[model samples]
Target: MKFIISVDCEGPACVVGNAGKALSASRDYNFACREATLEANAAARALFDSGAREVWIWDSHGQGLNLCIDQLDKRCKLILGKGFTCRFPGLDNSFSGVVMIGYHAMEGTKNAILAHTYSSESYKNIRVNGQTVGEIALDGAVAGEFDVPVIFVSSDDKGCREALTFMPWLETVVTKQGMGRNCALSKHPHMVQEEIYSGVLKAVNCIHQTKPLKFKSPVQLEIDFKAVSQAVKALVYRRRGWRLVGPRTITKKIESMREWIC
Candidate 1:
């Protein structure tokens, strides 16, 4: 068996700052990335224990290059670069399962750790048919396109809740409970790692029982931005329910996955 692990920063044990916008390396963004990688490694170890012969990790954080590779489990291969159309790269229909690590809340989440969907400069919130979704959901939809299943996800309380809404049976490890988007009560890194290991093992062992992660066809995606000009750019796709949110943002909602464009 083979598994693909997608790792993101900002929702691990103690993440709190925006990507790159963090004031210093000591900021939550950087700290979160390292912690996120540890979680990924734990999951990879569990995958191996569950009969997975190979586990590939996709570094899906800011700039698509956040995971610390050398410290990762030697049993896995890490994909760290910004070369894919989607953040999750080199993933195809062949993998037995997919796991998301250190994912945060969707854009506009209230009191959720480091919340932002795609780009903060790009959007204030992103909704699909009026429902909020995070990076995990969009990436999972891409995986669903190929008939792959998202078996596990790791993040804070909000992120885990988001995943459960889409894929109820998938396993999750919540490392933090946010007091706000930038403030959260987190477990120690060691405890977080323990949960990651156990969660991944359970996910892989029960992969068959875990349902696939999918969205309704003709998916309606609303992209709300922080600027009006950005919303104007979406005018071209108006036929798909794209609209401007006053003079400061854009919103689009489609019901079918006629095409995946981002």
Candidate 2:
């Protein structure tokens, strides 16, 4: 079977504070990048050993250049960079399932390590049909539009719980439990890698038991910006069904998941 492994970097196991550190040019950021690459390699190896013929690893974190290409498993293709048409690039119905690694919780999730939606500097919260969502949910919805299920996710405890809310049958490996936005009780990097390897194997093995998650047609999106200026900037797309809901919020309606993203 074929699969897409999307990697992010804000989970407890990867960083201790300011999720953005994973993208910075600092010592801590460098360590987080290495750790993320190691975890991805572990998952990719497990998938190849478990009979996955094609595996694409998408670096979905900030700047999308976090994974170490030279060190990644040679068996899988890597999608790296930004300004793509979709968050999960090269994704389509052809893939069997998706695996999200190193993800965190939604914006405003109390005690969630480095919680935020798309951008902490831009968005305060994002909701679909009135339910709050994070990057995991947004990516999952996009995958669902192509009829691909999210089989596994590795993140902090809060992120795993958030994913389970929409995908109850998904396999999740918690790398840490958050004490707050910047603090968490994290598992050792080696231990987390082990869990990820097993998690991917179990998820691929039980792929048939899960289903893709899709929202109803005419999807409504409520985006609350962190600042009024950000909300005003988004108003430039007002003709695209955007309506000012509050000083810092805008609501829009779209026909499909593709539209919701665009």
Candidate 3:
């Protein structure tokens, strides 16, 4: 079987502060990248050992280049760089299941480590079908378009719980429990990696029991921007069904996963 693993940073395992100082190119970014890569490598190795014929690792974090390519498991093909239209690039119906690693809670989640939707600077919150969502839910919905179930996820305690609301059958590994936005009681990096390895094995073993999560067609996406200026900027896409709902919010009706990502 084949699987696609989508890796992000800023979960309990990483993320030291706000977006500017915590993302790529910053002084502290390397630490996050190292941790993320370790977790991804662990998952890949586990999937391979469990008889997965092929594995695709997509670096879904900042700049889409955060994973340490040299340290990643050589058995898996890695998707790096940016400019891809799909949120989870190279994903399709061919994969047996999807796995999300190093994810966090949705925007406005109290005590969730570095919580935010797509952009911490631009978006304050994102709602699909009137329910707040994070990257996990968004990407999971995209996977649903291809009839692929998201079988595994690793994140903070809250993030895992949040994800369960949308995908109750998902196999989750909680790397930490958040004390505050930038503080969490995290397991050692080595320990977290070990859990991820085991988690992936269990997920793949039970992949057939999980089912894809699909939202109703003509999905309504409501975006609340952090500032009015950000809302104004997004309003430029008004012609594409983006309408101003409030001074700092906009809403759009997307017909398909392709439109949601684009």
- Choose the strongest candidate by lDDT: 3
Stretches of candidate 3 off by over 4 Å are 12-15, 18-20, 25-27
The digit string of per-residue lDDT tens for model 1 on 174-221 reads: 899988866788898999999899988888788888665667766766
How does each model score on TM-score? 0.87, 0.94, 0.94
lDDT of 3 by residue, 169-217 (tens): 9999999888887778888889899999998899888888899989998
lDDT per residue (tens digit) for residues 1-262 in model 2? 8989988877727576654443364446777778888888888988898899999999888888888888888888989888886557778889999988888888889898878887777888898999878888888998999999999998999999999999999999999988987778889999999999998898888888999889887888999998999899888855578999899999988877876553
Task: Order the numbered candidates by lDDT, best leading.
Answer: 3, 2, 1
**Which consecutive 10 residues in model 1 have the weakest lDDT in total?**
18-27
By lDDT, the better pick of 1 and 2 is: 2
- Candidate 2's TM-score reads 0.94
Off by over 4 Å in 2: 12-14, 18-27, 237-239
Q: Which of the two candidates, 1 or 2, achieves a greater TM-score against the reference?
A: 2
Question: Scored by CA lDDT, what does every candidate get?
Answer: 0.77, 0.84, 0.85
